[model samples]
Target: MTTSSRLADTPLAGELIRGALEIESTGRGLLPHRLPAWARAQCADGQLHMAESQPSGVRLVFRTRATVVELDTIPTKRVYAGAPPRPDGVYELLVDGRPAGRGSVPGGDTLHLDAATGTAARRPGPAGTLRFGGLPDRMKDVEVWLPHDETTELVALRADAHVEPAPEPDRPVWLHHGSSISHGSNATVPTGIWPARAARLGGVELVNLGFGGGALLDPFTARTIRDTAADLISVKIGVNLVNADLMRSRAFGPAVHGFLDTIRDGHPTTPLLVVSPLYCPIHEDTPGPAAFDLEALAAGEVRFTATGKPDERASGKLTLNVIREELARLVARRAADDPNLHHLDGRRLYGEDDFAELPLPDGLHLDAAAHRRVGERFAALALTGAGPLAARGRRRV
Candidate 1:
């Protein structure tokens, strides 16, 4: 018999296996309802290392034949010094209110959890799906327990579900790169990351290359993008570079061009949008190292300040205005010969008008509502052309 036929005859033989569960926080609490726990564990020593400002919560979940389930509880808001010292203790995973499994978070490992094993490590892999094998056909609830001293934020619960995969299309893929904001920071769910959301909204397949604190115009990253598959693509730049203060204008322009040149080597005519930074008050017109408020840190508040003098424009510091102007000029020069190249102000996606109504609590990342708004705008701008390969053509207004 054919492999497909043979597998069909055996119910579990070829059945789809479950992967890591992904869950995102709705507010300051867990997502509504109990979810199935396929697997769970604790990252004892590394449970405290997180973004400069984040709440403490556990990242736990289950993997099933078709879907991944996650359970997360909000913790008290506080600023952690660093990863806590190693603790030898049992982290519990409960499925349907009963103990399913337990594991220990090893010392010297990163605080981030591995979706597959549910242990925290000193360094985590790039964000992606985690897979698991064997699960009960149906389940409704799950819970995870960490030591009282440990804390975490339930950012995402990701898992593969049994739903039929969307039919594969002949469309060209879109490869994109950005920063933590693009990496889905502060998002409520894995699929809710702005790029993922926008990809879905635009009806295109996407390979998200966003990495937290990793989009510093690194040559390796540029090469990776240049080498990746894509019919058309864009890069959301500026914000992270500015926040990190990685490079000044002298190098920024060439880096941008070089990044494009590398990509063009493979995709000569692909429509590429070079996006500038979005609205950020502190970096609006200044350079870095962006100063952080120690008082805020002591108070468990996270904030950034411009480190440059208000009147000086020659300082090494960079502002959103500077990035935007450079990007527009760069694209204008490139578009003259490269018709497929384009530019978009990130503000067009999330502008001052939106901020006036709903300001970011941290002055950096967008909230769930703001993420949705940006996604919708991105969809309208990039998708909807003759076919997936054809450039939909954005007008320079």
Candidate 2:
């Protein structure tokens, strides 16, 4: 529906955004960025850039009485060469903190990605509108959650009534960083991602720094975590390091220590949890540098496989098992004096038994059901009794 005379453009400012560290006022409208400008400027990798641009847990929150709402956005969607077309990213509507509606824009810019070669050809498209009507005709808190897997540029927000920034949530912020699984992967929607789900279940505000193929233990990322204020902090390590074959055993331990040290600089005594990688059959005992399962891709399916030889572990190559062992040992060694530091075995979230029932379709990322399982497990393990944040007192889920 076209905006009536009473409808006015609601300035999409940083105050309207949650789960993002910065907002960039763009030529089109506004863009929410998970990583700050300085951290982004330090990395030139296309993967990191794209991952951060996809607002995994980001949402636009406001209080309004409008019965009709419209949002215009230009989403940069990725399409793999020769593979089946991916679905349009979804925008989830929450009214008074509950699911109310869901919609997707029809057209937007496209990134034609080559899965095998890791290259993308960009094609610009016109902006599309997502309109929600029949909203409750009274002042209510509304949230429009951006697509978890698409890079979106907010163009406009219009309503028949004035919109104001919603009151900030009175919950402790939970900052989490990890790989594609934490970035949503195949979780289906923005709030369905594991971290988002866990945040809801645990009653905490979420600041997710999970990046697809961009979780390398970079100094800049550590600094970002150090500066961001959070009541609970977690770093899910191992998966990306192994898949990218980024570092060997000798370097991994020191890198992890340094990452934790940087965060402690800002959050001295906050409850910090170091979670190891979730179980992945492909990377359990096999060292990586994982590669695409070309045969599956040829059949129009996406799958990943480990390429490093098992024997390489003897020479310092990292595998899921080795990384888990190292992380557990390091956390145990450090907890001697750092009482607030804790470790959770990643298998506790997704173990071999869970895998049997819900095998990872792509041999890497979790599907929607698996995402729910992991999220629920995380809430039980880290947000409740005997967990790292136990002292904060659990909220009703």
Whose lDDT is greatest here? 2
Cα lDDT of all candidates, in order? Answer: 0.54, 0.91
Which residues of candidate 1, in runs, are more than 4 Å off?
1-79, 82-171, 385-397
Collision count for each candidate, in order: 28, 0
Candidate 1 clashes: the total is: 28
Give TM-scores for every candidate, taking all chains together and pairing residue i with residue i.
0.62, 0.97
What TM-score does prediction 1 earn?
Answer: 0.62
Worst 10 contiguous positions by lDDT, candidate 2: 388-397
Q: Residue 131: error of model 2 in Å?
A: 0.7
